[model samples]
Target: MIRLATVIDTFEADFLAQYRDQLTPDHYRALAAMKHCRTQASPMMQVKCTACEHQKLVPHSCGHRHCPHCQHHESQQWLERQLKKQVPAEYFLLTFTLPAEFRTLAWAHQNVVYDLLMSCSWETVRTFSQNDKPLQGTPGATAVLHTNTRRLDYHPHVHLVMPAAVVDGKQKQWRTKPRGKAKGGYLFNHKALAKVFRAKILAAIETAGLTLPARYPQEWVVDCKSVGSGESALIYLGRYLYRGVIQENDIVACANGQVSFRYRNAKTTRRERRTVSGAQFLWLVLQHVLPKGFRRARNFGFLHPNCKHVIALLHVLLKCVPGQTLAWVKQRAPILCTCCGAVMAIVRTRIPSPFTGQLPISIAAEGNP
Candidate 1:
């Protein structure tokens, strides 16, 4: 596998020279962290073997959310939390996409535009659920914002995993969409969903004091399809939730002045490869680096963190077992000692690099009298 750090180290100078004017502080931060992640240049921690009196210093991971080598545990934790909140009802995955004309505007004001995209999408679904004859109440959803397509293009959209059920707080009841023989299942009319979503987002953009693109399409695209049980969809979204846009395994070749990577085509459902210059490839990945402190995945309504009690009550009311449907998350492997085959426990951290003008504690003690 071609590591992203190797590519970054190889093309750093050229990439910086070409794109320095356009790079943001977040992009620079991500680059610096990824370039040295788990490498000797990063800080180190001293770990001692539990069984034997042996110690060694290991390089620390960058812990950046965009670094592919880190945050596997966090991604799994998020998935488990979502799984625990699952209820016994049909689920749907709705995609609300910002049109191509709005890409430039979204890039310029990503914080505002992305926030509106997710919030407005939930609001649209909430409205439809409240107005529906069967489910006349508030609905919950787990919304994830995806800024890249399968080919790593700058396409901003929000994918919402919503159960076709609503909680009527006023009536103190739970209601689910009627099941029929319509193949996978059915929810709201997707065409009507598109219309309402378009109006809400367009109005929201103007309300946020941003100008709409003059040549934007009159019709926006919103896709809603049934995902039975919703476990597989959640797993799919969790795959890239904490990791960066592209995984290292997908990076097939990095030779000469160009890099190549593969992606599964959404239309054909087949693997396809794209090759671009090294600098351009770095830009393709870094361009999706979200702003600092910006959240990519969010829970809303009954699924919100504050509403845990609601989820608990619904679990009992719906007679749904939390862990029955989804498979258990495997525990992370512990770092073991090479000498005794025992788990190593960290004793110290933030050991300075050799280039930092300060020597590590052990090295400094050795030099002293």
Candidate 2:
């Protein structure tokens, strides 16, 4: 499988050499980070095998949020934290997608449009959950912003993980539909949900001083389905929410100035191959760096940070012991060798020469636990 670093190393120079003046600083920074990730440009550490006494230098990860190499470890860490927040409750997955028209707006004003998509989509769900027949109470939800589709196109959408049963406002208890009522545990009407979400988001766009063509499509897309278990959905969504647009497994080949990848087409329900020049591939991947400090995944209702009291009450509702707990655990680095499958120790860190124009890094000898 072809890694993103390989593609970036192959074509980042040409892409930057040709379009540096046209690209923004953030784009340049993300591309440069990807190109230099886990390379000699980054810091290196010397590791010695505990069993074989083999010593080798390995480059450290750049740890950019958009880097595919760095995000798997981060995503796994996040999944653990998110899993601890889960309650023993049935959950639903709801997706609110932007139409093709809004993708242009999102590209131009990502912060504003993306925030609006998240807020407006949540509001649409919250409002309907309060007023709809099947759902009469508010449901705790965590909305994750996804900027790319299966085809890796600039498709901005929000996926919400919400409780299948709503939490009562007055009673502070979880409630579900009567046993004979909604058969599928659905929250609201799909077409109706789409209409409301579109109207609200369009109004938000107008408020942002952008006007749309009057001839745009009347129907929008809003999907709602029961995920049965909330933890599984959270794990799946966490991976996509924290990672790069395309995975290394999707990459088929990189040679002769072209990169080829595969994507499962939604309409055709079959795998399809797409090949593009290395420069074009790098540019396409860089398009999803996102604005600096934009919080893509956010919790709402009882899960938010400011809702400590509400969270305690929720724990009571779930029969969990009530106490403020640290959920985000520190992630530990691996000691095992990637190549030889042997235990290893960090014997020292390699410091680049000052004359070479690289920043100084610490050198330390540490044994693996």
Candidate 3:
């Protein structure tokens, strides 16, 4: 199978040439990470399984979260840490969206808009949760930011895993509510949130006095969802961040120095076509993928910022403890014992993903044409 990294690396130059006119610092950083993944290495060990005698040198993975291949181990480690943070209270899946009018602006200023989206969403949740009618305590939540729609369009949004209830300060009570029970919770009362988000963004724009187009809308587009809790939501969120916001399946092809991709209508799921020059295609891909150090998925509230402490306190108070967590995450077959179906016990160590084969150029061909 052709790794996505291979495709990205081979076409990176083509992408840069196309996006040269629109390149930014973030784009450069993302390209650099993809192109130079090997430099940042993790500790890998080699050993033969005592039970199965499966001999192999296990290659270490680069721990960079942006690389899909590298995230499996890290994701498992994170989930382990989060187990301690699971509370008995219900959880709410909250989403915040921006209107179509801000599309152009968000594209031009990704760093700014992305930052604003997270900050504003947190503000809205905090405000509502702390209101006298709501949970009232400092309701903790984890917010993950996604920059694309199902079809991989640059439609930035934030997904928040909010506790169905929260505890504020030293108060001795825990508030629990069903997801979607809050008035305008799923809708998030976009009319009011739009005003708050718009005001926050407008203030920034005014402070910066950004150049605006002639036709800008007064209203903002926002959406919220309160998906119920289950294994489905966690699994869904995990895979949601897996592939590129824009998947290769949607990419038509690169020909005639141009590239075409498909997108689906949000409301209708109808396929829509978009074509760009080869360079433009490269630009779009590079622009949409996150920079190396920038994390698209973030944990907040009780799930982050010392999840151990907050969760420990919550557990002690709530008289709860999560089930046993997993040991080291399960790696793929290449590293596992074929006979025993278990991680090959570590014996020795090596640098980089273990070099399983010789370089293609190093192998001499029998004859030359």
lDDT of 1 by residue, 222-253 (tens): 99999998998999899899999999999999
Candidates in order have lDDT scores of 0.90, 0.75, 0.60
lDDT, candidate 1, equals 0.90
Point out where model 2 deviates above 4 Å.
Answer: 17-22, 46-57, 133-135, 178-184, 267-269, 308-316, 320-333, 337-342, 345-369
| lDDT at position 44, candidate 2 | 79
Q: Which lDDT tens digits does candidate 3 get at residues 252-360?
A: 6665666667777878879888876655555556557665455677776556666567678878888875644333234444456877877666777754453332211
Poorest lDDT segment (10 consecutive residues) of candidate 3: 360-369
Residue 14 in model 3: lDDT:
73
- Number of the candidate with higher TM-score, 1 or 2: 1
**Judged by lDDT against the true structure, how good is candidate 3?**
0.60
CA deviation > 4 Å runs, candidate 1: 325-328, 355-369
lDDT of 2 by residue, 1-369 (tens): 777888876776677665555466567667666666777777677888888787887887777788877767778777765665666566788999988866776787888999999999888888887886665787678899998777677789999998755777787566665433565566667899899999998898899887665556889999988776576678778766666788788989999989898988979989999998888777778788888899999888766667667666666667864123323333666778766888799988754522222221110111110
* TM-score of each model, paired residue for residue: 0.94, 0.83, 0.71
| Candidate 3 vs. true structure, TM-score | 0.71
> Residue 143 in candidate 2 has what lDDT?
92
